[model samples]
Target: MMHPLSMPELPSGIARVQFEPERVDYAAPEASGRQGGVQAGWPLWLATFELEKVDRDSADMWRGFIARLRGRQRLFLASDPTRLYPKAAPRGFAGMVRAGGGAFNGSAIAWAQNVDADGNADIGLTGLPEGLALSVGDFIGFKWDATGAAAGTYGRRTMARVVIPGVVSNAGAVTVGIEPPLDMLVVPAGAIAHLDRPACLMRQIPDRSSIGSIGTGGALSGAVLVAGQDLRP
Candidate 1:
């Protein structure tokens, strides 16, 4: 019954990727000891795909995506395996997809009037379609569901990664700057935010050297995969 997975249309021999953010450094003890570590929760997004030259059908499709992530009960929505999109946009995700006709920020409802912890905020856009652009590692997806909702229970999904970068201010505002923050507690302006491919909702830990095939001309390499340890569902 584990038939609820997504995000796995990436295959190209993967050269080198490393999506970041993997916190939980707590270590502020005292009594004559260590005292310099903070970040304590909500920081899980780690990708590290690294497939070298490939062949043999891209090494059997990267070992069939590391055997369908079965070593960890398969869940999906991973990203940044060298970036999924929004790195300059420019008609990429259809340049925000709907403009004069509405629905760019999903029917003009993308919001975020307040947010801080590190995941800065200021996204209140409208139909943007004039050569889109959002920089700094791009990756966005916050929710409380509003326009065209779907993440049941009123959406609790939240993903971030832009480190401060902006544009699109001809009215359809823009002032993003996210990080490891914005996961609810109060992000309700009805809350909504979306940028093409911002992902992170994972479960993986493949092994068996991850992948294989490295001889007889069909060169291949490890198809490593790792997530935030085990954040369970």
Candidate 2:
């Protein structure tokens, strides 16, 4: 029998390009619209990516992975909503604004993204650890690893939502485009994006009455997923 680790050959209709949003700074005029007036700053430039439903087998596999990534178990990373805020000292800029929580309005428990060399990608949840609890609108942060590297090398990580924006991916190909066009109504209000630390390992999984160390004694902390799209499919 084939070992469970022996991932099945991906079936047809599976796109492998993973997309994520990057946190960027933005500025706005003061309420009075006058000079020397206080201004509000927030995070913008939320990108997007699509998780093509590959074949029935691939889809099922992806579905399970996504379930775990977005699962209810709390994860601690290098970054969170607090760091996602605007770096500049702009007045009226609040930290950790809650807009519901989790993708699909909290219906799902976990989330994650994975991409291939050909730009093929997938994003979704796997499952939540048993006996874990999470309330709606709770603040979560993610530390994105920014150091790009070759396959198997450690790099930054970020948590973004899967937004199929007019892109199509099948078994062996990937296509990308803007879902909500820039300078348009693509990004929602009060949204921000940021990257996690390198090799962003999800360790120290919390249990019913204690936390367990899975990697480096770190925990898996959930972050506010604003929105994201892949530039390439």
lDDT of all predictions: 0.59, 0.26
Q: What is the lDDT of residue 114 in candidate 1?
A: 56
Highest lDDT, which number?
1
In the range 135-188, model 1's lDDT, one tens digit per residue, is 887777654532354555332344677777776665555766677665454445
C-alpha RMSD (angstroms) for model 1? 15.7
Ten consecutive residues with minimal summed lDDT in candidate 1?
Answer: 224-233
lDDT of 2 at 73: 40
TM-score of each: 0.33, 0.23
Compared with the true structure, what per-residue lDDT tens digits does model 2 show for residues 119-219? 34443322322222222212122222222434332232323322332111221122222211221122222222221111122322212111111223222
TM-score of 2: 0.23
Per-residue error for 61 in candidate 2, Å, reads 1.4
